[model samples]
Target chain A: MRVRAQMSMLFHLDKCIGCHTCSVACKNLWTDRRGAEYMWWNNVETRPGTGYPTGWEDQDHYEGGWKPDGDGITLRLQGKGKALARLFFNPALPQLEDYYEPFTHRYEDLFDAPAGDVQPTAVPISMVTGEPMNVDGGPNWDDDLGGSDIFARNDVALDGVDQTIRAQMEEIERVVFNYLPRICNHCLNPACVAACPSGAIYKRGEDGVVLVDENQCRAWRMCVAACPYKKVYYNWSTGKSEKCILCFPRMETGQAPACAHSCVGRIRYMGVLLYDADRIPEAAAVSDAELVDAQLDMILDPNDPVVIAAAHEAGIGDDWLDAARRSPLWKFVKEWGLALPLHPEFRTLAMMFYIPPLSPLVASVERELYRLELPPERQDFELFDRLDKARLPIRYLANLFSVGDEQVIERVLRRMLAVRVYKRRQSVEGVVDDATKDLLASVDMTPEEAEAIYALTTLPTVDERFVLPPYHREMSIETLNDPLAHKGEVGVGYLEPPRRGW
Target chain B: MSDTVAMIVFVAFPYAALTLAIVVTVLRWKLAPFTVSSISSQLLESRKLFWGSIPFHWGIVLILLGHLATLFFPATVAWWNGVPIRLYALEITGLALALWAAAGLLVLLYRRLTTARIRAVTTPMDLVVLIVLAVQIASGIWMAVGYRFGSFWSVGVVVPYVWSLLKLSPRPELLQPFPFILQLHVVSFFVLVAIFPFTRLVHLITLPLPYLARPWQRVVRMRHIEPVG
Candidate 1:
């Protein structure tokens, strides 16, 4: 086993409140620059709606990610030979129109306009051309508008759901949506890295953080087409590709990424995970239905003596292994099986996992003549069967997380339901119901296990949420320059301003 | 006075261009590695570029290969030319490639001038390089058409002169008898080499050569981390 420790994340979607605080924090920290005005490194996308850059998930148009060939996978964008052929001009590249024309309100007009009968208004001007433009779209134009026919109905994720079910989802009263905050997955097998003609994008081996070497990027924009998640963005002004760096400078100093630290909902969990590096290809090569299990299998138990020996042999330090043991991501993803990688069918072996949100119980209809109120004893029994009747179809959640496998979604949701029911019983006296017991029994989860899951999910402290591994900066720096010389200068921004042109 | 002018054009000017090209290219590479790119505006407008770029690149590459073979492999060219059919085929192929490249360059120049998006990104150096390349190609085609058999004759006249320059020996007398088109082609070629490092032509040196054999995935580690002994 080629044990490698990768810093991973688990975003509990059930806890996300759809606040764009993470987006703003990441923007202020990283992308608030001349060329990167439109970039949102951490964006909170409201699911059941078209996401940022509008319909990014529609790979049929964008042609991002990997497609399974005969046995292995190939990039949906282009191969090595084809990449060179299209190096001069990438026809598949998304234009500035695909992403809205970045604009700013001309607030000067409000103050400087000549005296008039009506109050002067600020008009929007294009950031690119600096001309007055009609304000039409933004990064999150369809935020929380799940019932809208324009944006939400066009969500490509809903394509896998049955046509009838999709229509039902779009109904005004029946509309249900959850917030899906995204950052770069820093995937184990990043297609962006594979498709880069300049070999500019690469995953850091020490912590598995993917970074674009700005100096090396030739602005081919193939990374924009290759990333299944569309996390990479082209800086039109700089003529280079830019992406989420995972706030590695902050990470090195034992701090969570800007987005995760500033998250209002406390949905983000960061930690170390030790996995078999040799299994990455095998894990990603599995059939879509088995992808989740295959990826989970790659994550070795940190406490296992054999694994620990292999990890030490592979040059992973003791501190990282200790961090992996306390990792909430490990507990939520592998141990409890609550969190799952998004769109495993993309086969990038994405490191970020999401705990699918639990929707409200599905309501039932009864004829006036046959309708009867549920008795107190039967009420508890009816609650146990609510999983099959959830307002959000199992098929829909499965399509998003489990690669169209309903069984996986059902298991995670059941466990979450059991924990909620168990917590209620603990908090309120005489609230203990036979249905709650049956729900826990069906999931084969003990009361202690349910309470443990509840504690970690609902009441996790900041330290528990983010188990930061020790970054050996001294060792890393010693290879290039003297660590002592650069000891005082440890932060994100460049020491000198970046020059613009050749 | 004529001999001095010939020496300046044939020896001093060529040497100066070569020196400037080498020194500036190295300096630019060291100082501004990030900016050394073709800065392809393909993202802005690709349709015209698709029609122009492919034929232009292939035509120029084949033509350059033919020029290099004639310059460095004269014995092989002479033997091939001994066969009359092979000589005709070579001349025809070279002329076709030159015409193809000229056509492609014209289309590119039109795109650069007419397309607003491309025109916006076009720097003065970009225009100069394009014009110089066009002039050089036109002069070459003129030489091929007027002189009829430059592929064989270039070995006798241009190769010896080029060899003399490499050996740091002045041989302006040998090239002075050549036609104005041939001399203009030689001057323009050296001028192109001089401006190459300063322009988008720097991308020519930065081709991802290892990409042909590189693995699908790349894992970059901190340099300090080494395998446990």
Candidate 2:
């Protein structure tokens, strides 16, 4: 067996405070430099507003990545139709101005320019040029998504549809409007990975968190162009590109990721989820809806000795084992069907899972359907604005969280299944108590359903394997003194020294 | 006063310019936020820009290598070291690669110039760099044709004299024997260098790996709550 260890993350949208502490922490730690001014590896974009750099999702406008025309693929760019056409051809869609213009200060105005005009005591100037005036915005502008106009317009539910599933769609829209946090699904099959030409991007062997190689990144910004979600950022100064790293370094130490750790809402959950790497290709080949089967197969029993032994043998630590014992990843996934993959469509099997928001609209519609004694089959189903036609809109729900899963189209009138979005009520340190499952079962489901939910949500298998090589097997802060001890350097981590006088 | 002083400035100045270019390039590469940071949600989500940029850079790097080699080659290597067969092969191959690279550069340059966002970011300095590079490549090929070429001895003298000065030797004999055409080329090179630090040519100083490193963290943001925009 290839024996690939898989890892995943879950962000409770309800708990996210959007303080951007994570962004700043990331910036301070990594991207606080010249060319990187344009890049935000941990940027928190307000939806409904054209994200910074604007219309990033509209690939047709920018001409990035491959577009599947039925089954055939065509490059989205212009002019290179067949031959080496012209010396200068136009891109169908051009790159956008994602960052504000860099500004400088004017220091001369203080004592030199005006010359004895009361000689202003203090020179009010910008930083770059040091002149005596203020520069408008040189990158990192209006931090709060510019203003509230963008926020007021954040609700997509207001956009009424013309389809027969109008009422249900409206309901679905209402719930999403209430609160639906969307994140990188970290798909099991990331389209972004498939689209990269340089092979610079890869999903981690242990956690399955996809990453782009900075050294290999020729600043082509193709990843920027291809990701439908527009997650990647290009660094103009560094002559390369960047994106979110799921914080494997921190994870290795048994600490949650920066975002998860700093998340004030405490809605984030970090855990080791055992997945069958062998079944990935097979799962990726299945229809979007049937993808659930592939994901389910990857699930391992945490308590199983064979898996435990394998995990320990793989170099998993005690902290990780303990976390697995208490992880809600097991409870939500294997025990309950509530926690679901964001989007199964784009084919990137994202590791991030969401507890579908069952909107009041869905409840109301279900009640009405039950009252009428009519079977809610596909033929009679009202094509709700967001819900899937079958059980619910899992596919469409997936798109809300991922890039290309067409399964979202199959979902018809779906909405948020859980209320209290962005609230971090779940505990990462405590194991799920059986009494809670019994209580939930008594109120919401039959004994069998409750047990199934419990089984899915409880951490069944703990993977203690270290996907990191032996050199990384046991490391400490002291190891930094011996540069060679830092094994990441041998791999893609051997970053080029910064250019002189930088 | 000897013409050596002028020659010294002429030859020595371009290296300074090259240094400045190296600095800016390095700073841009090393300290830039995007290079060291994890992949941005914006970049990863866009598929097309990602791929288009790859070919664009390939064209750029190849062209740059060809240009660097042509501009800095030793005269002995150009003439006396006398591998007629190798020289002929190199010249032909280099010229072909240069042309291909130039074609790609033109495409990329055109993309930047025409794109609204890119154009906005592009300063006069950027345009100057492009124009200068274009001219250098064009003139290089023109001179490569073996007609009206600067003398090898002149190039040989000026290049070494300049190097000696950089090494703090300030040798005058290196410049005493060079031709006027070579002097003009040396002067032009200095002018290019004097302006290099102030332009985008500064990207050279950055070490390739750190300049290109990507973070592995995957991020998902709340719908309405973008990170303070």
Candidate 3:
């Protein structure tokens, strides 16, 4: 295997506020051309919802990644194979008409109001509905700063709730949901990489970012169907497919990704992760579940001489090496025990990590009211309503920290305001920066209070030598046990071996 | 334009596109081999796509040649020219092969639409080009099998038009009375031409020698610098 570099990203969902700034910034930069209107290199999705194209998360429909059974993994191709092929030999997946078509209105449809016509003019109505037209669904229908349903399903931490919490929910149906501020996970076993008949998609070695070549593209559009993330898009005018470049241009200059750089919640981290170049092929070849451990092993230990030597040999700078140490995976797999992959079953070796939120405020508030023998609903219900109306803080925090609780307002605010130190360049920046202390104070936390929470969680929490299931290690060559592989197809091919260092 | 002339230009455009596409593919292979990034492994994919596209295109050329013979050769002259029945049979068989070729092209297109590698490389214009080709082939087949308009005489104009193009004097009058199917085909054909040079379709004319001139095996300097974070 040749020594080509791979790039990857690790997103911290606990810190993302679902503002569309990143989406707008990306759209303004890359996809603003005519015919590129529908393309968005960076988009925010509301979890538990259908996502942008609708039903994007349903693997059965898209057939993106490999699903493991007993012996091996099966490649599902419901979106590709012969069954669907007969429909359009050069089939166009159902276009806008196949879904709900978007409509725009002509100037004639609106009434011509005079300059001083002030009778409280109402907005023009939709032609289809004859009622006020409202934006229904897109990439982020549920991203209104609240917990989306996706968070609710995946957060398994919240179990066996206390009676005091249940008592607070007596009058309301306290259903819990989650919101995942998703971006390209830059998988170890990228389905788009595997599905390319032309083998055009690749994961970079330096940062693990995935990218596409325009000149070599034959305009096949296969990656569109192969990516479960649906991040890849086709450019009609150019006759080629496009996707997030991972803002490599910005990264090279030592700036964060646009989404990460602009994150209001400060939940993102970017760094150069050094892995064994040799293990990539093996990692790509294994089942998705087994693939996770092979990937975790690739995380470079900064203090390891061999890893340090390999980084020097590979031409990576020390700044990047230092940044790699700060990654959440370095904490979850190497430091903390609680952190886990979002959907280990997908087997893409997704790099993003979430340190499940633990709402001390919510727990404290509920406990104090019960001790005083006061009704749970009477304590600052107005504040609760306002926070609940926004929805995201409650929904996302519940999913990350406390799952299945319907009453999320007070708990969510207390947790959000709990963050104190915002780390930048390995040096700590006070969470109550001059710009945000006012907003921080309103949540009832002093700058000192937020800093304390940051100090507790910043250190490594997971042990580096922690043993994972055998599936996480490199599969034995003799165990070439894929039942679904096309006859002689060997496993994924990797050129470089993992960097071995203490 | 007379059907004969229309057929010639239809056949020639492929030759032009094929020639230019071959040259571009070859030059890029040798000079800018690394210009095609490892992002999607396009070096390997470009080869497969090139081969699939070749058969589909060459098939169209052969099919169009047969169409020209039917339109231009006089029936009496064909008999005196010997083996009229055999020649007519060959023409019919060629038309069938053309339809089959179109279907094969559709298969290739479907692969692009559904596969991740090809799909990522695909532009909306690429799909539009495929859709246009599909429509053209469908309509041409309809016209060949007794689907008609007000007059067959208009087709004679297309023949003259083809001759004029070969002579560098495109005669629009020959195409004025052409049937709807033929007119629709002609108008779409021009639109495809105007956009051909600007698209990946340009590869069709640039890579006729395939890998002989393609430098897919070489490692070259990549164009994209690593993005800093």
Candidate 4:
């Protein structure tokens, strides 16, 4: 089993508050440059909306990600021959308009303006051309469903649902949405690395961090088109594609990435997952129905003796193996089966997993009518059978996280609900009654496991959440050479400092 | 004095240009490798680029191949031109290709000049390269129209001279009889070759041709490359 250590992430969507602290932190670190104002390396997208770059999930228009040809998958953008032919004019590329025209207020104008009856105003100016422009869209234009009528109605996930159900989603009170804060998945089979004509992009084997060699990036912009999540962005000033480096510098020293570390909601979990490298093709090639299972099967149990032996043979150290065993991502994604990859149908085998957010329970007409007939004093637990009527449709979450596997979404949400109900009963009711037991039994979870899930979800320490593996390269460097050898030269400087032009 | 100038332009200058091109290209590749890209402006303005780049690339590529064919198979080209109608067809085709290339070059130049974003991103080298390209294309079109049947006469005269240069025997006098426009084409070409590695023209050698045959997914194996202590 060619075991390889993959550093992965799990986002517990249940806890995310949609505050965009991660977005601002990442922007300040990576993409806050002249040409990169349009790029959001980390963005919190409000789902049930069309996301950044307008209707990105519609593969027919944007054509990002991989397409299943027969058994194997090919990039949905274009094949090799077609790609080379269209190198000059990448028809699939998202234009500046597709992403919003980045603009900033001319704040200096407020102070510069002469005193007048009207208050001094900072005119919005396009960052690209420095011309006055109307602010039409932004990186998070649909935040909290600000422009829900147009943005939410056009979401690609809603396409497969019943027309009436789709219409119901647009209704004011019936609406449901969740925050999907995204960074690049840094997939096992990254289409960006495959599509790069310059062969500049590479996934570092040591930690599986995807990086773009800016010098070699010929501004082909193929990576921008190929990434299914649209995480790779083109910097027009430098004429190159730039993406999230996953904070490898911080990670090497056992610190969480800036975004994860700065998270206010504590939704992000970083960890190591030991996987069978040989099964990547098989896992990614599976049918959409089996995608979640295939990906899980690919993630070898770190505790397994056989897997540990294979990992050792693959040059992995004991520290990394230990980290993998202790990984919160493994428990959330595989052991507990709470987190699932976003859009596994993309066939990129996205390393980032997410726990589908639980929505408020819908009180159906029958349930409410039945409640009215009975006395208020007799009402006790109304949780189990009512799960099928969650305000957010099972089909919608399935479309996003599980590729239309409604059963998968139902089970995850059921488990989450059981934990809450189980915990509330202990704290509020002061006992573990049979009603709570029946609720836990119906979802097939023990009280101990529910308690463990609850502890990790609500009360995890920073160390428990981010299980960073040992950097073998850094360790070797420290032992073989002096850590302070490069001293000032290596501390701060861009290898190839970006400039305007020749 | 004219004989000396001809020798410098035809024999000495061409050799010097080729040597400079080769040495500088290697040095730049080793030093500032990131600069070796045909950085696109399609992100800013793709509509004008489609009109400019497609015709320019396809037309120039075909025309360049045509130039190479005439030089390599001068005897075969002369034999084909022996027929009167065949000669006219060949001449008309060369002129048409030249016109097509020139038109594309004009569109590309105009786009760069007119577009605000494109003008901002453009470098001194970029403007110089475009102007140089314009001169070469304009001179070629001028020669094709003003001095007709260049494809026929060039085989007998220019072919032998160029062949002698390749054979390491200087024959600057043979090209001396050519008009100023014809000489300008040769001079502009060598200058382009000299400045090639510094401009976006380096991307000509950097196209990922292997991508057409390689697998869809690429996983870099850096394990073996690094020295493990």
Candidate 5:
């Protein structure tokens, strides 16, 4: 096995409140430059909405990500010959209009206004040209389903659901939505790396953080189109493409990423996963029905004696291995099988897993105000097997996470309900009920395993959730140069002029 | 006085252009690698670019190959032109491509002048390169029409003259019989080469030819790139 370590993340989406704190934190750190005003390296999206770049999931139009081509896979974007020919003008590239033209208010007018009867209003100006412009759209225009008619109705994933459920989804009384905060997936089979003509983008062998080497980028802009998530953004000022770096500089110093660290709802968890690098291709080449299981299979068990020895030989230190064993991502994604990747059909093998949000149960309203939800003390023992009766169709969640595998979504939801039942029975009744035990067994989970899931999900501290391995930056720095040697010298000096290369 | 002027234009100027092109291109690439680019204006106004760039590139590529053939393989091209039909075919094809290129360049120039976004990004150097290119094209078109069948005769005179330059033996007398337009074409060609590194034309040498043979996926490890699988 060609073992490699990957630092991954899991979002307990149920806990997310759609506050957009993580997005602001990431923007303040990385993409606050002049050209990057429109880029949100981390942005919270409302599910059932058409996302930031409208209809980005319509890969047929944008031509992003990979497709199953007979045995292996091929880029959905054209091959090499066509790519080189189109280098002069990439027809597939999203226009500045596809992503909204970033703007700022001319707030100076508010204070500079002469004494008048009316209060002065700030006029929005285009950030690109510094000219006055009408504000047409923004990064999160569809947040909280504000424009559900235009954006939510056009959601590409809705095509997978039955017509009846799809119709029911739009009804005001039956509407359902959730928050989906996104950053670069740092995919194992990254399409951005594959599409770059300059070979500027690469997946780091150290921790699998996909990075764009700014010095090597030739402004080809192919990566901007090829990423299925549309996470890569073109910087108009420097004439280069940029994306989320996962805050590698912070991570190397043993800290969580800005987005994860600043999550207000405590929904984000970060950790390392040891995976067999050799199996990446095989895992991605599987059929759509088997993709979720295939991806899960590639993540090697950290405590396995054989895997541990293989990782050791493959240059994984004991510290990283220990972190991998305690990885919350492992417990959430592999052990409990609760989280699944968003849209595995893209075949990028995206590493960011998400626990599908469990929405409120469908309401039975008679005459618009008859039903009342009882207090928590009332004895209730309803079966969670009625997945079909949830406010949101299971098919929609299936389409988002698995490739139309409703069974997978049902299993995860039932297990979560079972865990909650087991916890509540212990806390409120002060005794374990037989019904709760049967419910746990029905989901194929023992009480001890359920208790572990409950503890981690409900009451995990920051340190426990984010198990970071030491990057040993000091060792690498010393090998490259002596810090003390630079003390006698004035500033940095280049021994050789920089040249463009792979 | 005429001999001295011809020597400067034909002998001294060619060498100067060549030396400047090489030394300055290397320095520019070393000192500012980021400046080396096509500096494409397609993103600002793509419709005009598509209408202009494709035809211009194709026309220029074939015309360049024709020039190179006359320089290096004069005997072969001369032998092929022995038949009147073959000579006429080649001459007509060259004239059509020149016209096509000129039309595309006009469109491109109009777009750059008119488009607000493109004009914002335009530099004085960009304008100079365009004017230089226009001079070269206009001279060639003029020579092709005014001095008909010059290709059949240039093989005997220009080939030997170019060879003499490469051999370090200057020969300014051979181009004396040529018209002023023909001389203008030669001088303009050298001027284009002289400004190669300073302009967006640096992209000509930076073609991603390596991409054709290289693997799609890339993974880097420990400052050393792993062999693409």
Candidate 6:
């Protein structure tokens, strides 16, 4: 077993409250620069809405990620021969309009204007052109407009849902939505790495954080096309591609990434996960339906004795293993099987997993008196059975997460329901209902499991949410340079500011 | 016009170009490893580039490979040229490749000039390089056309002159008698070599040779030692 440790993240979707605090923190820390103004490295996208860069999940248009070719998977963009041939021009790249033109208010107009009946307002100016312009779009243009037909109706994830379900979702009174906060997944099988002709982008070995060596990036933008998540951004000013570095500088100092640290909903969980390095291709090569399970199978159990021995043999330290054992991601993803990777059919084997959101059941409208109807057969059933009646169809969640496997989404939603019911019973005055007990039993869950899930999801402290492994910077630095020589310096910065061109 | 100038141009200049190419390329690799890439503008304009790039790269690659073979393996070239049919075939193939390269370069030059996005990124050096390359190829085609039996003649004349330089013996006399265009082609070739390390031409050296054999995903650890698995 060629075991390797990958730093993984789990975002508990049920707990997310749709605040853009994480987005602001990430922007202020990283991408608030000349060419990167439009980039939100941690944008909170409202689900059932067209995402930033609009319709990024429309693979037919973007042609990002990997697809099975014969026996193995190849990049959806181009193969080696085609890559060399089209080395001069990539047709699939997104334009500035696709992602909105970054703009700032022209405050000088407000200050310099003469007094008149109409008040002088700050006009929006294009950051690129430095000219007065109307604000046509933004990074989060669809934020909280979940019921809008223009934004939410165009969501590609709903393509697989039945016409009835889609119609139901469009009902004005029954409109429901959830937040989907995204960052670079730092994938195990990153298509960006494979598509980079320059060999500039790479996944770090010490931790699995993927980074673009900006100096090496020739701005091919193949990484942009190859990434199904559309996380990679190109800096027009610097002439290089950039991406989420996963806050490695902060991580090395044992701090959570800015997005995770500043998250208002406390939905993000960070931790170490050990996996067999040799099985990456094997996992990615599986059929689309089997992709989620195959990827999960590749993540070795941290507490397994066999895995522990292999990890030790692979030179993983005790502290890292301990961190892995305490990982909330381990509980959510592997042990409980509650979380699923987004667009596993992309076949990049993304490291970030999300627990499918459980949108509340749509209330029936009757002569202006809205009421939730528990079906006659399910009247005796527990609240968990109401998952089938949720406003957001399980098929839509399945299409987003499980490559159209509704069973996986159903199981996760059921587990989430079980935990909520179990928690409600404990907090309220009533004893646990027999129907609730039967519901838990049907899903192969116990009261203890539900309680444990509740504690981690609802009541987790900061320490429990982010279990950071010790970053042995000294050991890593000694391999490439003298650690003592640079003892007092910060590890991650350029002495001079980066400029355009070579 | 004088012996000193001729010696510098023919002998001293070749050595200087070779040295500059090697030393500066090494320095750049050490100091600015990241900038050593082709800096492809593919994302900006693709349709016109698709037509302009493919033939240009293919034609140039064939021409370069043929040139390398003739330079390094004079005896093999001579043996092949001994037959009239083989000699005629080699001459035709070289001329065809040169013409193909010239055509491709013209398309590329047109695209570079006309495309707004490409023109924006086009530095003066980039234009100079393109013009110089076109001139070099045109001069080469001129020599091939004007001087019949150049495939056999160059084996005796240019090969020995190049070999003499590698052997550290100045033999400007061998090239001195050649036509001005042929001489200009040789001089411009060395000029390209001299400016190569400083330009995007440096990407030719960093062709990602290891990529073919490398695993799809690279797993680099801080430690050099292998795991005990």
List the DockQ of the predictions in order.
0.40, 0.06, 0.04, 0.48, 0.34, 0.25
Q: CA lDDT of A393 in candidate 5? A: 78
**Quality class of the docking in candidate 3, CAPRI style:** incorrect
Superposition error at A284 for model 3 (Å): 4.7
> Which parts of model 1 are misplaced by more than 4 Å?
A116-119, A362-384, A429-431, A478-484, A488-497, B78-96, B110-122, B141-152, B223-229
Per-residue lDDT for B91-133 in model 3, tens only? 4665676677677678667767765445644667667777777
lDDT of 1 at B101: 89
Q: Which of the predicted structures, 3 or 4, would earn the higher lDDT when compared with the native?
A: 4
lDDT of 2: 0.47
Q: What is the DockQ of candidate 2?
A: 0.06
Model 3 scores a C-alpha lDDT of 0.49
For model 1, the DockQ equals 0.40
Highest DockQ, which number? 4
- In candidate 5, how many Å is residue A427 off? 2.6
TM-scores of the models, in the order given: 0.91, 0.54, 0.54, 0.94, 0.92, 0.87
User: Candidate 4's residue-wise lDDT over A1-502, tens digit each?
Assistant: 8877778888999899999999999999988998999999899989889998788777888788888888788889988888898886888898888889889999999999998999999999988888888999999998988227888888888767777777777777567888998998989889899898778888877678899988778888899989888989999988888999899888977789999999999999999988888998888888878988998889899889998778788887788888899999989988888999999988888999999988765543574462222234323443345555566778889999999988898899888888988998899989989878998998889999999999999999999999997675544566656766744346477765676334
lDDT tens digits, residue span A154-224, model 3: 22322343334433422233332334555666666666655543445676654567777654554445566
Q: Which parts of model 3 have CA positions greater than 4 angstroms off?
A: A1-8, A68-75, A78-136, A144-172, A284-291, A313-319, A326-329, A337-339, A358-453, A456-502, B1-229
Q: What does candidate 2 score on TM?
A: 0.54
Model 2: per-residue lDDT, tens digit, A453-499?
33333322223211221113344433344545544444664344543
lDDT tens digits, residue span A1-502, model 5? 9988899999999899999999999999988886688899998889898987878899989999999999999889878888888886778787777778889999999999999999999999888767788898888988888226788788888877888777777888777898989999999999999898888899988899999987667777889889999999877666677899999999999999999999989999999988998998999899999999999999999999999888877778888888899999989999998999999999999999999988766656878773434434422443375677777778888989989899999999989888887888899999987877888899899988998998898899999888898887766666677856744552567543332221
Weakest 10 consecutive residues of candidate 3 chain B by summed lDDT: B211-220
Residue A450 miss distance in model 6 (angstroms): 2.4
What is the TM-score (0 to 1) of candidate 6? 0.87
Better of 2 and 3 by DockQ: 2
Candidate 1 interface CA RMSD, Å: 3.4
What's the distance in Å from true for residue B217, model 3? 16
- Looking at model 1, residue B116 earns an lDDT score of 62
Weakest lDDT window of 10 consecutive positions for candidate 1 chain B: B220-229
lDDT of 5 at A395: 88
| Candidate with better lDDT, 1 vs 6 | 1
lDDT of 3 at A191: 64
**DockQ preference between candidates 1 and 4, better one:** 4
